[model samples]
Target: MKPVLLSVLALSGLLSTSCRQTTSQAPSQAEINAIGLKRGSITMCGPAQGQKLGTASFGTSCPAAAQPDFNLALSLLHSFEYDEAEKVFARVIAREPGCAMAYWGVAMCSYHPLWTPPSPAELTKGAKAIALAQRLAGKTNREAAYIRALAAFYQDWNRTEHKVRALRFEQAMAAVHAQYPQDSEATLFYALALDAAADPADKTFVKQKKAGFLLQALYPGQPHHPGILHYLIHTYDYPELARLALPAARQYASVAPSSAHALHMPSHIFTRLGLWDECIASNRAATESARCYAASAGLPGHWDEELHGLDYLTYAYLQQGQNQLARAQWQYLDTIRRVSPVNFKVAYAYAAIPARYVLENRLWQQAAHLPRHPGPLDWQQYPWQAGIIHFTRALGQAHLGQPDSARREVAALRGLHSELVRQKDAYKATQVRIQLLAAEAWTLLAEGKAAAAEQRMRQATDLEDHTEKHPVTPGEVLPARELLADMLLQRHRPQEALAAYEANLIKHPNRLNGLRGAATAAAQSGETAKAARYRKQLRKLAPVAPNPEAAAAHLSSYRRP
Candidate 1:
C-alpha cells in the first residue's frame, strides 16, 4: 500500500472496514515485491532538491521500490498540487502494476474538499478509480480497510447528499485513525476530514477546533509536514481564530515554496489579521510562482491560481495606499485579459481590480464616467461581474451629482438582482440587492433627502451584515455600512457615524475608508485622543514619502475635509 492510496482511501471511504487489528509483523522483501513494492526499481519523481514534507509511511505492505515515488506524490497531494500529484501517481502505477494506491490518487484528485462538492461526473470517475483499486489482490487487511472507507464516500451515488457523504467519510476516517494511532499521515488526514465536514455557519468552529488540536499535536514531531501546516491554516481561517495560526501561516510558504498554493495560503491569516505588508509579500511570491509554473507546464491561459494571488495582492496594495502599484496591477490584468482565456477567476479580477482601485481611491468622477462595458472581457457569462461594475458606477454618478444616471444604474442593478434570484443564487442575488439599496441611498443623498438616504443606507447595511464576502473575490469595493457611516458624518451625526464605522471595522479591519471615517467621526465628536490614535495607525499603514513637504501633501490628499 502507498501512502497516497491510504490517504485517498481515508478521504473517500473506498476501502473495507472489516479488519481492525494492526499487523505486528512486517512483510518480507519477497512478499513486498509480490504485492508490487519492488525495492530499487522506483525512482523519486519531480524536482529532487525542493522542500521535503517529512517522512511518509506506506506501511509494510508497500513495495520498497515504489516508496520514493509514493512519498513524492503524497507530498504534492498534501500541498493541493492535484495535477502534479496525479502525474506522479501515474508513474507509480506504471512502475508497480499491482499498486492499488495509485488509482486512489487519481480518484482523490477528482474530489477538491474545500472549494466545491464533487460533481456527478467526478463521482462517477472516482467510482471507477476505486473499482480498479478493489481488483488488486495483494493489498493488506489495513489497505483493504482504507479502500472500504473511501468506498463509503462514493457508495450510494444518488442517495446520500454531498455533506452527508462527507460526514460519513469523516466517521470512516476516525475509524482509520483509531486503527493506526502511530500513523502521522492517517492522523493528519483525519483532521482534514473533520474540516471537510465543518459547518461554515458554526461560529464556534467545533470541528475546526478538534482538527486544530490534532494538527498541533502532530506538528511537533512532523515539523515540516505540508498537510499539517496547510490544514492548520484552514482550521484557523476565521478572524477570531486567526491569531493562533500565525506560526503555521508564517512557516507554510517556506516549507513548500515551490507550491503556488502553499505560497498563497499564508495571506489568508495575514489578511485576517490586517498584516498588509506580509499579505502583499506572500501574494507577490505566489503570483510569480504561479506564473512560472504555468509557463513551464504549458498551460494556455493565465493560471487561476495566479489570478487568485493577484486579487489578494491588489487588495493589500489598496489598503496600504499604494495606488500606483494597485493601478499597475489592474493594467497588467488588462493585458493578460487580451491574451488569455477568460474564466470566472479572470472575470472576477477583471471586474474587481478597477472597482477596488476607483472606490478605494475615492475617484467618484472616474467611477461615474466608466463605460457601460469597460473591457473586452465577457461579462454575460458572469453577470455578478457586471453587477459590480454597475454598482461602482452608480456610486460614482450619485456622488458626482448625476442622480438620473445613478438611478438608471440602480434600476439595472435591481434587474440583475431579480435575475440572480430567478437563477436560485441567493448569495449573489443578495449582493446585488445590497448594491441596489446603497445606490438608492446615494441617489437620495444627491437629492438632499438625508433622512430617506439614511434609512435606505441602513437597510443596505443590515442586509450586508448578514452575509460574508465570497471567497472568490478579495473583498467588497466598499462595504455598504462604511458608506452609511460616511453619509451620517456628512449629515453631522458624527457620534452615530463613529459607531457605524467601528462596527464595520470589526468585520473589515484596517480598511482605508473605514479607518479614515472612524477617525474623522471621532475628531468631530470631540474624542481628540481617539482621533489621533486612528491617524497614527493610518500613517503607519499608508506611510508617506521621505521628503517632509511631499509627505505632508500626500497625507493631506487622503483627508476628507
Candidate 2:
C-alpha cells in the first residue's frame, strides 16, 4: 500500500484507496460445492457480495473458464479457508503452468491468516506467481490487470516500485472500464485509482475536476458499489460531502449491513452535524462488526476494535466528551503494542488516537508517553507521519506553557518542512507548513510575547482560513482565534482582544470558548452590563456548578498577567 493507502483511509475514510480487485474466474457447480462458494459469496471486493465479475452488463459470457480447481482455490483463499485454499491453489498451478489466476492464487495465499510468518516457501511461491503474472500478462485478458496489480502490490510492500505499480493498476482499471463501461466493479476501481492518484500533481485547476472520473462512476444508474460509497463518504472533507453524506451513509449501511466499515460514514457525519445520539448509534453498530474482524483474523476470542474496525467508535466517544472511555481504549492499544510493537499496519492508529487525546484533552504527560519521533524519510509510512507527532507535541507543549521547549519543537518542525521542500516532498511539506505556522504562533503566545504572537498569527491567517490552503481545518480557526484573543486580553490590549474574540465568534458562532473569552474581555474593560449578558450566554452554552472561590481564584490569576 502507498502512503495514501494507509489504514486511516482503508475502508471508509477520506484518504483510503479503492478496494482491491480480482480476476479469478467463477468455479463450476462441483467445484463450488467443493470449496463452499455454495455456502455463501466470499467478500473479496469490500462489503459487497461475491467477487465482481467483468464489466459486461449486456451478456454473461464465460470467455474461457480457467481451471475450476484454481477458481476453487481462489474462492477459498479469499474467504480465509487457508488449508483448503492452498491445497486447491497447488492443484491448479501443478496442472496449468501459465494460468494467471493460478499465480494470483499463490500471491493471495500470503494474505491468509493461518500462514503465520512469511515462510521462504510461501515467499518463493509468491515471487514465482508474480513473475508468471508479469511474464504472461500480455497474452492474458485485461481483467488480469487487477491480478498483476495485486501481484505487484504484494511483491513490493515497502513500495520501492510504487509509481510503476500504481501506474500499472491504473492502466488495468482503464482497460476494464473501456471493455465494460456498465460494470460497476470496474467503475469503482477506476474511481479508486483516480482518488489514489490525487496526491500527485493535478495538471488542472478545477474544483472536483480531477476527481470527476470517480464521481461519475458513483452516481445513480451505475451500481451502488459499497467501496465507492464508502470512499465518497469517508475520504472527502465533511463540508465537501456534508449535504450528500447523510443519504449516502444510509445507503451504505443498507448495502453493507454486516460491514463495520459501513458505520464510519454515519458516525462521522453525525459528529460533524452535531447529532450526538445518531453518532452513538452508528458507533455501537460498528463495535458489533468488530466480531467480523476477529473471525477474519482467526482470533475468535479477540474483541479489539482497533485491529479489525475503524477507530470512529473511539472518535465518536471522544467527540461526545467521553474521555475516560477513550483513555481506556488507548491503554488497551498500549497493551497490544507492548506485546508486538512492530505491527506496522496499526502504526497510524497508535499515533493518531493518542495525538487526538493530547490535543483535545490537553494531556501533555500522556502525549509525552506516546511516540513523537519520525523514522528516516525513506522509511516514512504515512505522509501525516512525516510530521504529525512533532507538530502535535509542539502545540501541546505550547498549551502547557513551555515556550522554550515548544520553540525548539517548532524549529525542528520548520527544519523538517524546509528539508521536505528542498527535496520536493510536496504533500508532506504542505502538511508541515500548516503546523509550522501554528506552532510558531502558539510558542509566542505561550512565552507571553503578544506582539510576536500576533505577527505569527497574522502570517498563519494569510495562508488560508480553512484547511484548503493550509493543513489546518476550518473547524479549528475559531479556537485558534479565541486563543490569540485571550493572549491579547492578558497582555492588556482589551480593544484588540475584543475584535479578535468577535471574529472568532463570527467564525464559530456557538463555540463556548469564544463566548467565555468575549465575556472576560468585556468584564476586564469595565463593561459590566455587556459582560453580564455574555456570561449568561456562556452559562447556557456550558453550565458548570457554581464555585465563587474558584471563580475569584481564576479572576485573580488573570489579573496577575
Candidate 3:
C-alpha cells in the first residue's frame, strides 16, 4: 500500500510525505483499488482552495482574457496542485471555448508523471480531455506541440503499460524541447519526465544527474518558479546527491510559503542529510499550513500533508534526542477526527506514524499492541500498511520472550508480502520482505538460533541498502543495520557490533540508535576513545530519551528461554 505522505514521487515518484480521519464500513475490493491502492494518489478537488499557490508565466497563444487564469493554472500544475489546476483550467476553457491549450491543461492536470500510473478512470479522463484538445486544433505550432506531447501517454492507455507510456511521453517531450530550444517550459517539463521515467533500480543516477543539470540551467531565469525548485529537489533527493540539493531545499520553503507541500518539501533533503533541526522546522510549518487550510476549506478533516508533516516532525525530534517532542506528535494524531482525501497516502501515514513512535522509543509492549488503524482510517485497502503493524508486533514479541507469538507476526508479514507481490506493487513488496526477514531473524534469535538469526539480519540489510526509502518516510521504521548491530551485541560480540554500528552511521549519520549502540559497543570492546566520542556527540545533540521503554526492552530481551 503506497499510502499517503508520499507525493509526486509515489511511483514514477513525486515523493510521498501524511493523513487525518473518520471511519466507516470497509470499501469493497474494487472500490479500494479504484482509489489509490494501485494508483499513487486520488485527486484532491480543492486541497489548496484558500492558499496562495506560487508563480508561473507561460506565454501562450491563449486569448488575453484567459491568460492570467491560464498562468495561474499552469503555475499550480508546476507545483503538483492537480485538483486546483484542473479547476482553474476549466475556468480558462469557459472564457475561451476554443482554446485548445486550455483543454491540454485539463489533460496535463491528470498526468502525474512522477507519481505511479493512473487508475483506469483517471486514464480515461485524461485521454478524453486530450482527445478534445486534438479535435479543437491549436492556433499555433507551439500550442499544437504541447497538446501532442501529452498525447503520447493517452494514445495507448488501455493496452500499453504505464512505464512504457511514460517513456513515450518523455520521448515526445524531448522532441518538443529539441524543436524549440528557447522554450523554457518544454525544457523544464522534459527534465521532469526524465526523472519520472528513470529506473529506480539504476543506482548510477545517470538520469537524475542529467535532470539536475537541466533544472539548474533554468533556475536563474525563473528564480521563484515552483516547478524549477520542486523538480530540482526531487531530481537530487539521493544520498550521494543530497548535498547538491541543499540550495534548492533552503529556497523552496520561501518560494511558496503558502503551500503546505512546498513547506514540507525541504525536509526531504534535510532528512537525507540528517539535518534534524531544519527537518523539524520544515514539517512544523507544513503541518500548521495544511491544518489551517483544511479547516478554512471546511474539509472532512486534516489533509494528508498534515499527517505527513507530523510524521517527519516526530522523526526529526527523536533523531535530535528530543524524545518528549516526538511523543507529542502521536498525542496530536490521537485527536484527528477524520481525514479528507482518504487514499493510500493517508492510509500509509496512519499506519506508519504510530509504529515509528513506539519502535523508535523502544516501547516494545506498545509496539506489540499498536492498533491496526485509527478508527476513521481504512486498512482493508492497504495490506502493506497492515504488514507494518505485524512487523512491529513481531519485534515486540521477539524481545518479550514470546518467540511463538513473534513467529505468528512473521507469518502475517509473509502473507502480506505475497499479497503486495500479487498486486504488482514492487516497492511495497520489497518493504514487506525486509520486514519479514528482520522479524524472522529476531524470532530465530529468541528461539536460540543465533547464527541463523544473524544470517537473516544480514540479508535484510543487504536488500534494504539497495532501495531508496519511500518519500512518505523520514527513514526506515528502524535501520536494518542497527538491528544487525543489536544482534551482534546480544551475542556478546562487541567488536563486530561496533563495526556494524560504525558502518551504518556512515550511511545514516547521527541516528539516535546508531550513536547509542556504537557508544555501548565501543565501550564493551575496550575502545574508550570511540565510546567517549559517541557519548560526546549524544550529549551535544541533547539528553538521552526520557522514557523507560528502552530499559523495559532490555529486560524483555533477556527474558528469552
Candidate 4:
C-alpha cells in the first residue's frame, strides 16, 4: 500500500517472487484438488509448451531454427520464468552452438528486476554466464548492447552492493533504450529496471512515473506481449496509479495463461484498488495455475507461489465478508505438507494466512492458543514473521481479558524487535517495533489503563505510516489504526473513533472491519449521512449479511459498557 509499492519489501518471493530447490516426485492428490486446475484451456501458446508466453519478436541474427526457441526464451524471461527460460536458451545453444544471444538470455535470467537479491551462488553463476556472452559476442549491434548492459551488474557484484549494481544496470539500459528507440524489448526492460532501481524512500515516484510513461507508450503496439502487460501492471501497482493498469491487469493472464505468475500478477492491481471480487477471481486462477505449474515441474507438493496465491485469495475473500470461502482456503492451507520453493515469500504466506483467519474472524480463543512456533517451519529463521504470531495472540488475549498472557506475548515481540535491531535489519526491526507497540497498547487497555493504551496505539500508527509494506503481504494482519479505532469505539468515544476509521479507510479502503467500525462509530455519533455512506459500502460488499455475529459484535467484545 505504498505510493511506490513495487519497491520490494516482503512478498517479492512468490512466483516472479521466489526460488529454491525443485522437488523430484509427483505432487500429492490433496494438493491438486485444493487448487482446482482447468484442464480444458490448454492451448495457451503453441506446440512448443502449450503456454501462451506471448510474442518475443527479437531480431536476432541467428539461424531460423534457433530464432523460435530464442523468442520463446525471451518471452519466458518476461514472465520471470527464469530457469525455464535458461533451459530454452540452452536448447538454442545446442541447436546453434555459437549463438551469443542465448548466453545473454541466460545472464538476463540471473538478474531479477524486482525480486530478491541474487544469492552468492546465483551471483557466481550469472557472472560466469555474462562473461561467456561477452566472449562469444554477437555481430548484431543490438544483441551486443543488450549483453553489455547486463554485464554492468555482474562486473563488481562481489564487492559492490545490490543497489549500486542495480543503478548501474539501469543507467546502462537507459543508454541502450536511447540508442534503440524503436526496440520494444529495450523499452520494456529499461522500464522494469527503472522500477527495480527506484528508491523506496522517494515519495514522489519519479522513477516509477517515468517507467509507467515509457511502458504505456508501447502498450498499444504490443498489447498482447506478456512482458509489456506484466511490467505495466508492476510499474503502476501503486494505489494512485493502479486504475491506469486495469486493462493490462485484466488481460495479462490470458496472454501467458500457463504461467502461474502471469495469472497472479493482475491481482496486485486489484488488491491496490480494493476490487474484492476481481481480486478473488484473479488469485483463485493464480493458485490453480501455480498448482498446475508445480505438477508440471514434478514438484513433491506445491510451489511457494501457491502459498502466495492462497494468502491473497484468503485476504480477498475476507474483504468481501466471505469467511466461509476464507475458512475453506484455511483448511487447504493446513493440508500443505511441503512447498517446493520456500523462502521469505513462502514464510510470509504460511504465517499470514493463518493469522488473518483468526484475527479477521475475531476468534480470540484460537488466537490466544496459537502455537509460538508453527512446526515444520524454522520459526527462528524469520523474526519479522514470528512477530505476526505474537502480535495476533497479544491482541486476542487482551480482548479476552487475559492481560498477563497478552503482556507475555508483548515481551516476546519486544525480544524479536531487539534481535532484528541487533542484526541491523532496520526494515524488519521497524515492523516488529510496530507490533510491539500495538500489542503493548492492547495489553494496557486490558489492564484498564485507557490513556496509556491510546497513546501507545497512536505511536504504533504513526510509525507504521512511515514505512511501506513489502509486496508479500496484502496488508497488516491487524492494522494498527483500525485497532486504535476499535479501542476508541469501545471506550464510548464514537466521534474520535469515526475520525480514526475515516483516516484508516483512506489508507486501506474497503477493509471489512474499517467499514464496519466507521459505520458503527458514525451512527453512534449521530452522523447519519456518514453512517449511511459506510453502511452502503458494506451493503455493496456483502448483501446477504455474511457474518451476522461479526456485524453485531464488531465492538461488543472490547466494549467497556
Q: Pick the candidate with the highest lDDT.
A: 4
Q: Candidates 2 and 3: which is better by lDDT?
A: 3
Worst 10 residues of 4 by lDDT: 12-21
For residues 416-460, could you state the per-residue lDDT of candidate 4 as single tens digits? 999988866677898899999999998999999999999999999
Query: What is the C-alpha local distance difference test score of each model?
Result: 0.75, 0.51, 0.77, 0.79
Error of 1 at 317 (Å): 1.0
- lDDT string for model 1 (1-561, tens) is 111223554544343342233443333335433333212222222235954444444653557888887787788788887767767776776667567777666667666676556767668767766656666667776676566667667767666667767776677778888988887877877898898878655668889899999999998888788888999998888767889999999999878777888899899888878899999999998898888776766667567788888889999988887877888898887767432334556777777888887777767777886653344466775777778888989988887778899999998888888888776656678888888899899888888787898899999998887665665666777889888888888777899989999998887788876887789899999999999999998899888422343334323333422
Ranking by lDDT: 4, 3, 1, 2
Query: Which ranking of candidates, highest TM-score first?
Result: 3, 4, 1, 2
How far residue 359's Cα lies from its native spot in candidate 2, in Å, is 3.2
* Model 3 misplacement above 4 A: 1-53, 551-561
How do the residues 1-561 of candidate 2 rate in per-residue lDDT, one tens digit apiece?
A: 234333312322211132233333433335322322112223222344643321112111122344455545533442333444566555554445445555555665654321122445555555555555444433334445455445544455343434434444454455566667766655655655554444323323132343444554455653345555555554343444444556655666665554444554455555455454565577666655555545554542434333323244455454444656666766765655221213322444555666665555545554433474232223253444435577677766766677788877787778778887775556557656766877788788778776787787766655434434211111331245665676677678777777888886654554444566688888888888878988887665435432344344334424535
Q: Candidate 2 clashing pairs?
A: 9-16, 13-234, 13-235, 14-234, 14-235
Predicted candidate 3 versus true structure: per-residue lDDT over 254-279, tens digit per residue: 87776678888999899888888899
Candidate 3, RMSD to the unseen true structure: 8.7
